[model samples]
Target: MAVTRSLSTLIFDLGNVVITWDPRPALPEQYTGQDAEDLLTRLDFFTRNADHDAGKPFAEWVADLRSSGDAEGADALQHYVDHFDRSLVGLVRGTSQLIDDLKAAGVTLYALTNWSAETFHHAQAAAPALAQFDDILVSGEEGIAKPNPEIYTRALERWDLDVRTTGFLDDSEANIAGAESVGLTTHLFTNAVDARAWARDMTGAAGV
Candidate 1:
């Protein structure tokens, strides 16, 4: 018979889970609608952004774009970087309350996120609730990103968290899968309400 471990710790993913991240809003007004989408696609924005999250400097990425004759894309990326704060629209609705409830219950909280090292400060300033976390492991700082088993392993090891008692929540299915691969209890976060319910049930938090 296997003993079930009570959930006492939670690992959170920042983007889309705790805070919303959308690059479209960071683009120039002229790049609105399909044009913005096109720009991102043409630049392979997601891929490059992932690289940035892995600690590749944005200046180097822009230089690479310029060298590839995508000066327009390069310029656009620079502008987006300059106005990165605009991309962190706001905290996900209900997340603050959920975090507060969990904190009050003495649940251990930590954040694991894939964000550029250069720009993560913007998110810190934007979301006051982030301070509730006992600690945050940033991909850009570690040169590793989610959906990679290594980072999950590192987080668990670094935090001295037990896989059986620690729960991981992420908006991205890929990230959730990564956590699961490492034997963690996982939650696919669609909304704060569902997430809060899951946390409450798992942790048996009082008044949560």
Candidate 2:
């Protein structure tokens, strides 16, 4: 059976859902193309990213990256990180189409992302498409991250939403489970083609 109209909101994960996520988009400028993956294996961007995402102090993380590795190479890497759009992984297939479709159908749209406050605005600027969201909940800004039920709670609770009728779409299973635990319907998003199609069909059926 299709979900009902009681779930009037559609929450989307930003990175893998709307725009793509490449942790080291600028690494090739600092290292050999083949070694980019190797360096990424050794470095933990996401781990270093946690503090920023939670909206805590993050000057230390930046300093560490600036000081690691060969001074020149590290500096080169820092330059890329400072200037290039590392988060511009690419638009997930069909993201624009889906968001546009959702708005046209009168479904409320939101972006629920575990992102750093430091880089979030920069990313939004780089990807002009982010402005489409009706509500944006960034982990850093909210001081909460997903996979944590609290974050999901904030999404519905703060918005006075009916969880059982709301939709949460993310690339992470943990996040999906978290949202589901809070009585929210979730889509375990993988590829954009199927996801966008699902979004269109599901929301249409729900009359949202």
Candidate 3:
């Protein structure tokens, strides 16, 4: 499928889109089975974790949880800090190749990720594919996060890119909608195979 959209910029979301990240590996071993599921449910990782991405003081948050008598929760958060690198399992299959293809196609690439600045250091060193991007906008550093219109505007302003010709790829429905609200051509990412095909069609960057 070809879009004939004349895309000049391709914006990518990092976690689960370009790289595989899961906090389960960093969680304590004892929290398993139903208990583990309960812990996850109780913690509300995505919602609570957003605080971290929004530049909240990590130590203060943990201390507050501990002071509230949720020592186990505090320990879990600490475990995340300690084993942060482990959370990034590896690159998402085939995205590195797709990024190379986009670069080879002369499309300017940039990253808009709702990741904590503290944890993103591992990617700068371990994920070579990220190096292909012209620049990366991290929520933690920006003190804002996705599904927020401001961050999208900030990305566009920072890169001096036109929203009409830019394409965005992300796994979250809310984030995709947020990009659409800001006038970015959006793709809801599922896997690299489909993403590559969509990108090729969208950007007219069809060659290997």
Worst 10 residues of 3 by lDDT: 1-10
lDDT for 187 in candidate 3 is: 92
TM-score of 3: 0.94
Residue range with the least summed lDDT across 10 consecutive positions in model 1: 1-10
Instruction: Give lDDT per model, in order.
Output: 0.92, 0.74, 0.88
Cα lDDT tens digits, model 2, 1-208, are 8634444678999887888767666655656566766665555655666666777645555467566644544554455457557647678877777777677778888888998776677668656667878878899988889888999888887778877567889999988999888888888999877776667665763322
Model 3 clash pairs?
A: none
Could you give the candidate ranking by lDDT, starting with the highest? 1, 3, 2
List the lowest-lDDT window of 10 residues for candidate 2.
Answer: 69-78
Between prediction 2 and prediction 3, the one with superior lDDT is: 3
Best by TM-score: 1
- TM-score list, all predictions: 0.96, 0.83, 0.94
